[model samples]
Target: MSNYKPIDAKREEFRKYLEHAGVMDALTKVLVSLYEETEKPEDALEYVRKHLGGITESSSNTDALRKELDESQAQVTELKAKLAKFETEAGNE
Candidate 1:
């Protein structure tokens, strides 16, 4: 005895499409690589994005993000120093 709905049939068709397109094999390789990692990535989505190959965001975009992060960190450090100075001046008053 078995029960299968139209959704199940559609899902089966989609699976076949993926298999035909070699998506399943590509996915399997990425999963295996993830499983074999001695220290798993903090960002699994990024890891998968990298392993899936070629569909990456431009290096220029990543560079821009990195530059923004560095600038933000520098601002934080400057703010911390100013706060520390203010606290010291307040305490002395």
Candidate 2:
């Protein structure tokens, strides 16, 4: 039998969190674009910067983030209400 190791919970949580945030998808697209270049650009840093510079630059995206936060909070409130209803039904059953 082969030894099957369990995934670390924290790392898995973080990966899912990044995926939920679209960070992994964005980075994958940038890396794929870099890989498809026929000839590497003279300034490798510039090439990567051109493709990936905005990944961590949140200062310029504050309004977008605020909108997302508002939407997420609304979703949380909806889910919590659903959960509470389910719990009440379960208790009654």
Cα lDDT computed for each candidate against the true fold: 0.88, 0.86
Q: What TM-score number comes out for model 2?
A: 0.48
What are the TM-scores, per candidate, against the unseen true structure?
A: 0.50, 0.48
Ten-residue region with minimum lDDT total, candidate 1: 51-60
Kindly report which residue stretches of model 1 are placed more than 4 angstroms away from their true locations once superposed. 1-7, 54-93
Q: Which stretches of candidate 2 lie over 4 Å from their true place?
A: 1-4, 42-45, 54-93
Per residue, candidate 1 scores C-alpha lDDT tens digits across 1-93 of 679655788899999999999999889888889989999999998999887873346667888989999999999999999999999999999
Backbone N/Cα/C clashes per model: 0, 0
lDDT of 2 by residue, 1-93 (tens): 879988899999999999999889988988888789998788877877767866667655867888899999999999999999999999999
